[model samples]
Target: MSHAPTHVTCSDVSFEWPDGTPVLDGFHWAVGPGRTGLIGLNGCGKSTLLKLVAGELRPTTGQISVAGSIGYLPQDVTLATGARVDEVLGIRATRAALHAIEAGEATEANFAALGDDWDVEERALATLDQLGLAGIDLDRTVGELSGGEGVLLRLAALLLARPDVLLLDEPTNNLDLRARRRLYAAVASWTGVMVLVSHDRELLDRVDQIADLRDGEVRWYGGNFADYEDMLAGEQEAAERMVRVAEGDVQRQKRELAEAQVKLARRKRYGQKMYENKREPKIVMGARKRAAQESAGKHRIMHAEKLTEARERLDQAVEAVRDDAEIRIDLPATQVPPGRRVLTATDLRLAHGAAVAGVWEVRGPERIALVGGNGSGKTTLLRTIAGLVPPTSGEALTHVPTRYLPQRLDVLDDESTVAENVARFAPHATNNVIRARLAHFLFRGARADRAAGTLSGGERFRAALAALLLAEPAPQLLMLDEPTNNLDLASVRQLTDALESYEGALLVASHDVPFLESIGITRWLLLDGELRSTTAEEVRESRWED
Candidate 1:
């Protein structure tokens, strides 16, 4: 497909928090007319950078020039009280232009204002329709929409604007499996330049490019997340070699400089001290002085220059791969013997309102992935397992203890501190013990005391997961519902590593195919009206990139 040339060009940008801590340092990034996945570890300024690109936040230094109009769906948006999906779309300027005709406000001036061809109404509806949001009434209030619906409404508004660039920040955070698929499909169909910040491995895989941000810089990887991982591994190995070489050079230079210093010292000492008593020629003394000065100056210059060069080379090498500095905590979790049939269901069915029901039966340590297009009922099955909903007319039983991580990090208490939340969830543990445990999860000292509500999405998820692990005896059956929704690459890796080492059964319902595979998922139960066993080969095919 021939594509238009759309891009977001930023040059010499720098940003610092109000408190003066540097967040971004002379950052330069470029995104072109294709889906570019923004990958970074948690707290790495990915969201902040995305905001700057979206023009929501101005750069503290330098200029950001976007080639065309912009559409931004931020990671967080609180719908007005009692507002409905329809109302949110209506707030968009393009939608207003379309609505003007119905109210007889589409005057000659309005037509001329749209430029030569006019027909602004048609264009507006077409844009909305492309996102599968057309024909929705504008009067509906935003407060009545479901979380997933609210997300789609915001997306619809952005797309209807026919933006030259689209910036979506953590777009899949609150979406269920079905909604996520829909969102992905919508993104896939979008033709303009797109930059999205998300922890969703599935979404990252689908994009054309992956920009892995660490500290304040970007490393462009031309492929899906898996490909990026492979490249990153190679880069890391190369960087290590460079660091070793630089270290050796520095050592060699130090030895040479030391030798030079010794030689100069010996030469000076060998010279007779003919200050007043010895009959030494003045010309000879002057020659000696000149020789010593030249030799010392050469040694000093070489040593200083070599030292400066070595440090720069070493720093460059270190910085090249430092983006992956996130600790990969690969320690094994405490084991719990799995009971027979972790969860069982027969002819189970569930649905919300007019949406069709989803049915399935889950048993064993299936490592199941509820695969389906967006709007499918992957989350419903998880909720059913959690006993949040009763099946329409079927039998279901869970024989082992099941812990659920909701898609929205809902396990965390907004008002309570991280330590408090962990302690509350773990009643048997004392305060000191709980604090120590929280520290293991990277919530230490002042961080542990901070309110859970104020923590970033990744932090909140980690805190919740830490709390879950602290459960007495560790859950025999763990259920993670879209667990990668808001996680950055580091958090994702850490969580995956922990889960891989977990001894208990895992039933993760996620779109993160690479993550599931990395942790050794052997089987899957594709959610639909019927259950299907998926092998590794099948799972590979189910990857978002495929």
Candidate 2:
């Protein structure tokens, strides 16, 4: 497989946006027959590189060669509302021509359209079944499917093409646990050269190798995500050791330079005293003083050069260490007493017709994980608790202030800057206060001044999170729906770090089991037609049924 004639090759490629913002410069890459996981921070061009390889976007300067046909499944899958499943699969015309020929209307046009695929329908159905879409009707419209189903449908279409090279970009973004499992199975069974860009840790754990895209370059790592982490941990340890050694060398150089200067000053003072006391002749003393002064100048220059070299080495050492800043801020005002009721839903029935027949009370700073499949009213439940949706039967009450972060992250005004958005949330806070808080979210100075609309996916998430957490009332109760959907691993880690300092009650609805576990969830409630208490193991083992 290593010598499979390079299924895809990108040589000296350069890509830039229309406004001259560079994404990749002089990049080079090649992939053979195997599964490769592409990972990086947000805005690092993982998706853009996939687009270039799939021919959706062309590189401004270099050449990309493909050995055969290519198939691509984009991050956001959108199909025409009126188009049928078969049409989206690219086999509608072929199926029609085959049917016509079988019905005794074997015209030259029908025969030409049929081509060589005599079992097109069967192949399409098989591909759909392989992706867990067995029961889906080929005649159904694309608009009739749920978001997760739509993503799977797009993957099904790609599989039907049977291309030599395949690319998937965040294929599991909207998928639930079961759907993600199906997609994972598909990825494991891929035979041709495949490259996938995703933040899904479970999915990435199945790849043959990892290609870390950072600073416009790809660094290859053998084995899966777990192996990559182990390897990276070793490298970081070595880098940190080097940094410490370099720091010690710099301090030693400074001390030696200071001692030399002090000794030279003492010698000059003694010479001046001897001259004043007339211990030697005036001409001889003058000559000795001049020689001493020249020698001191040379020694000072040598020490200064040594110190400069040591400082340079220290700078290089620091650069070798990865200094990815994390979000660290205290939310002291958000604290709730152990007995204080944060939220209560008593016989609540949502305005959307989903009902919770029992009373549910959240006390203190409890972390709740709301688990459910797609279209299961998890968002509605959170919205109801936050008072965005009114209950039809009973009340959903919060004793303290509450904030809801929707899945789309529409909490902030797109036209406003990050600091301005935070100010909008906390009208009483001063400009300096807002800027200081924004810095904790990794948006320092001018970065906090950029409009929310221009921020990348991860930056926008951080801004929205900052706005919510730093509000005037301080969000004693926070509700988040799928907060980790499109965030890269680094951003997810930052979110986890930020939440670590929050003392408020948390109610997050997400399919990310590892994230939920990391946040110290005290309760797990499964949302179907009713609110049912569950556990982490149960959530992991349970599968969605059709």
Candidate 3:
């Protein structure tokens, strides 16, 4: 595909927060044409860089330049409550002007406002339809839309602008499967200078290239996310080999130095013995001893320098190998017996009007995936199972202890420290015990002391997970809603690893199919007006239409 001629450039950019913590330092990046996936671990400033390029943020030093107009969709998008859809799309004024002109009240101001956009209303509707918002009325209030639909509406607005450069940050975080497909199609069709910061594997796969941001520097890769992973694996393997070689060289140098010292000591002893035996004149013996001492000093210095160089090489080689941490913990207490019933719901009807008209039971350590579109009552159903919401009819019961990790992660207290939050759940655990277990969740030392309000997105998620999993009585049934919503790829992997150690039944509601498959989901249930048995293949192929 031929891309348009447009450039997004950053020259010697440096950014820092008010606390003097630096994010980007002397960063230089220039992207043109094709889509570029900007990726890094959480809190690595990928989103900050995009904000700078979009003019939402200013660089502490240097400048950002765009050769053409730009459009940016932020990670969290919220519209005004009273704003109409067309107003959100930024075409309301033009649409109104066109209507006025058609009504024979063609004023000079109306023509000026219309400009070349006489067909603005048609184009706006078309863009909305393309983004899976065809059923959305342009005159409808923004408050009437679901969260996922709101995100799409904002993207549709950006599309209506037809900017040469487009930036998206975690655009698919709230989207369901069908909405995600629409987004994927839109991304695949982009033919401009586009930069995206997302952990969505499918979305990253559609990009033309990948730009990795680490340690305040950007490294370019030639292809999409999968290609980037392959390249990274090869680099890590080579780095590991280099580390091994350097370690061996260091050991050999140390051994050679030790042998040299021993030989020097032996020579000194022989020289002293000869002098004591009066084998030569005293003055000649003393001169010979002085020369030997000088030679020994030179040899020692040379060996020491070589050892230092070798050790430095080893350190550099180790640094080249990435040390991304993984979560590893044992949850033996959460195990459930094979014949035990974990949860049961009978003819339940939720406050949201979604019905579970038949008796359903979750037994043993089954992993259930709840799949559905936005507003299809996935979260409500999870809440209903968690006992947070009472069913309007029938009964929902859990025989085992249950824990729910909500979509908003409101279980954590912002004012409390991470350790304090965990302590709230596991009051009987000692401080040392809690910290020891939190280390497995990647919170160690000072990290555990940090306040919950100050954590990054990934850190906050980890803190919440730690608090929930380490709670008193040990929850035998764990339920999570959209657990991977804003997590980075590394955090997502860590989450998978954490869940691998969990021995309890899992009832998770999410649109992340890959994540669901990774954790070994044993059953799939589709939630529309009722929960029904389904398969992963069917879920992947199905589309929800209004």
Say which candidate scores most in lDDT: 3
lDDT of 3 by residue, 1-546 (tens): 124468988999999999998999999999999999999889999999999999988999988999889999999998998999999999899989999999998899999999999788889899999998999988999999999999999999998898899999999998989999999999999888899998899899999999998888888999999999999999999999999999999999999999999999999999999999999999999999999999999999999999999999999999999878999899999999887999999999998989887899999999999999889998988898888898899889999989999989999999999999999999999999999999999899999999999998899999999999999989999999999988989999999999999999999999988889899999999998888988999778654333
lDDT winner, 2 or 3: 3
Which 10-residue window in model 1 sums to the lowest lDDT?
A: 352-361
Report the lDDT of model 2 for residue 505: 92
Residues 352-457, candidate 2, lDDT per residue (tens digit)?
7777877789999999999888888899898888778788889987889999999899998999999999999999999999999999999998999999999989
Estimate the lDDT of model 1. Answer: 0.72
Clashes of 2: 0
Against the true structure, candidate 3 has what lDDT? 0.92
Name model 2 segments beyond 4 Å from true. 1-4, 270-294, 544-546
lDDT by candidate, in order shown: 0.72, 0.90, 0.92
Q: Candidate 2: which pairs clash?
A: none
In model 1, where do residues sit more than 4 Å from their true spots? 1-22, 25-35, 60-63, 77-129, 132-150, 172-192, 205-210, 220-230, 246-319, 323-339, 344-364, 371-384, 387-398, 413-454, 526-546
- Put the candidates in TM-score order, highest first: 3, 2, 1
lDDT of 1 by residue, 422-512 (tens): 8877788899988877766787799999998878777888888888877765676788887877677788777876676566667777666
Best candidate, TM-score = 3
Better-scoring candidate (TM-score), 1 or 3: 3
Q: Which regions of candidate 3 deviate over 4 angstroms? A: 1-4, 544-546
